[model samples]
Target: MESLLLSHSAFIPSQNKEVGYLGRKLQSSFYGNMVSNNFALRSNINSANRSVMISSVFGIGRKVKKVKKETVIPEPDYRIPIVLLGWSGGLIYADNLAAAVPIGLLGLLLLVQTTRVRFVFDDEALEVKVGEQLEESGENVFVGGKNRWKYSSFVNWELWWPNFPILVYFKETQTRPEGQVHFFPVIFNGKQLYDVMVERCGPSKTSAPKES
Candidate 1:
């Protein structure tokens, strides 16, 4: 799971920003209620993954003083997607790691010069914060940059390689290099996030990938 930590672009932790654009949008909000949520997550993670799940999921969460965020889970399966900015080059998916090495390294240098990403959410949009997040575990730090994806702007999406899942939250306005797309992997308490998605955004639709 940590194999792609470099590639997993997501937010550190945030809540103050919600008072910006998202606050206005929450007026006509969708989720006005709460219910019991208990999802059956994959329980067989190794110790390393278990540690990650604990730290990222419960170590500390985005602090929202007035606004209510869902309960935090010490462990969950579906990690919220972040804004991956590398994982690109002129290479295609390969039959083995040997052929992919040089190509992966070529574009990965761009990542070294950049800060990691993280996730935030409001009634209207999913926020992926970018830039350097220095300080103690991102608890009180503010991310200097971010990306936005409004719920309505989204039409469909695909999650790549479940082993190291990549969120492709297709939107009407997306136009970036696929290389950058692979890094921002978001983590979340799966059940809570799903409940919000279903209620506010409506039920999710699923499909099989098209064969070319």
Candidate 2:
């Protein structure tokens, strides 16, 4: 589970807003999937009497650490937290609007360096987080258990991002309001996720026709 989530998270393509790119949108999709999964997992944890705690963020420029498992979730700060859960899960954090200014400014100076954000999936849920390593720190979102995304709930998973090896999409639809929402799983277990989707959810109608 750990290996699959980490590989999937690492595989997510980073988008640039400079060229009419959809980085933010893509990021949103990833986050949405994370949330959907986390919600389901958390529900299960509650029912099963197990709990997941997220620590607060710490550390200096370009890096952060979680103080404890139940730490207050990041609020407008790039300071991401480290997630611990009986060795089954991990967490990641991203810059909030308030902290984005400083963090983004610093990010500009480091051009050559690269980091891998780690994400995880357990029996009950999914998570996104940075590791202790300097380059491998970011954000963690949780989804799971009762509230998990069912194959039916997701309308689609699109591959709109270029340059990145993998892209996933999720959608929610309603009759009252005819609209479409897209979600990406920034971090996931590529083969496992793909296999599960294919098995449980199947593919969307609009997906690029599989090359035969």
Candidate 3:
């Protein structure tokens, strides 16, 4: 009986140790799985946040607005032609027929051209077109000439006799690779033309006269 009791006590202690070891192993496994799951969840959240930030930044950049410039067209003027015709008449009255006849014809031609030609100043370019309705861009007198010229292509420009502008002259590389010079009688409003030229082409060497 004594021997049997001792054996039973030894068996009880061995079984208890086995049970404790199993419980400790199970607890460690549960904690390790929890820690791994938590780390994975955090990693996923960080990735989503990073994606949202990048998208938002790009979205804000795309939302920026651009302002559009308005087109400016100068009013038609016939002052140059009228002045020429009057001067021709004065010369004829003075009996200077040699110069008067040619000057009178030139004045008449300019008068006709004044009725047809139009200068259009748009946001990006200056366009010379013909007709009362501005429907026709007449054929360029020079070979390889273009009716339209961008302000950016202008090398230099001038309003001759700024106080009483009689001519408009500009040199540009748009028509020819080497360069091209153009001269036009100032048939448009001088003040309007000067303003637009200054605004679009930049400041000129001659300053505009102060307003009275």
Candidate 4:
């Protein structure tokens, strides 16, 4: 009976040792799994933060829109008509009545036209309109027949006597496919006219008229 009791006691200690070892192994495995899950979660959060920072700094995935502004047309200028009247007066002073009569009449006509006519430049075309309200002028008296001309149709343009501009000449295919030439006295501000022409129709082929 004493020998049997000793064997039983030894067996009980071995069983307890096995149970403690198994419990420790299970705890270690559970802790390892938790650490792995935490590491993965932190990595995902850091990746998301980096993506947001990059988008803010570099303007990625953002659309930029452009706003177009309206073009402002210049006011009428009377330099041409004033010069014509002055010339006519000079001729009368010189006692040249024959030349003075025609010259003075032309000056008067131009002065009247200058008061009513205005050159309106839009984004794509140049228009000749009359009065304070800017009503469209009827068909042109000269060739081309129309009062409006698109910048794209202009084949060439010139400002006569650049220093003291007198006439503006431009040829366009808008009226005729073969190209029609039109001439106008520079009744508008020369600088403004030249600037608008260059901007809308591109640079002129010739800046000044050729000497005869």
RMSD of 4: 5.7
Clash pairs, model 3 backbone:
none
Off by over 4 Å in 2: 1-148, 159-166, 174-179, 208-212
Model 2, span 55-157: residue lDDT tens:
1222223355544322111111111111112111211144244555444444432211113333333232223334444232232133222223334455555
Show the lowest summed lDDT stretch of 10 residues, model 3. 203-212
Q: How close is candidate 3 to the true structure, as a TM-score?
A: 0.72
Q: Which residue runs does candidate 4 get wrong by more than 4 Å? A: 1-69, 208-212
Candidate 4, clashing residue pairs?
Answer: none
- Evaluated at residue 21, the lDDT of candidate 2 is 61
Residue range with the least summed lDDT across 10 consecutive positions in model 2: 77-86
| Residues 69-94, model 3: lDDT tens digits | 57776776788888888989999999
User: What's the TM-score of every candidate structure?
Assistant: 0.32, 0.28, 0.72, 0.65
Pairwise TM-score winner, candidates 3 and 4: 3
Task: Residues 60-129, candidate 4: write the lDDT tens digits.
Answer: 9889776542564666677777777888899999999888888888888888887888888876788889
Ranked by lDDT, top first: 4, 3, 1, 2
Strongest candidate by TM-score: 3
- Name the candidate, 2 or 4, with the larger lDDT value: 4
Report the lDDT tens digits of candidate 1 across residue range 178-207: 312222332433344444545444543674
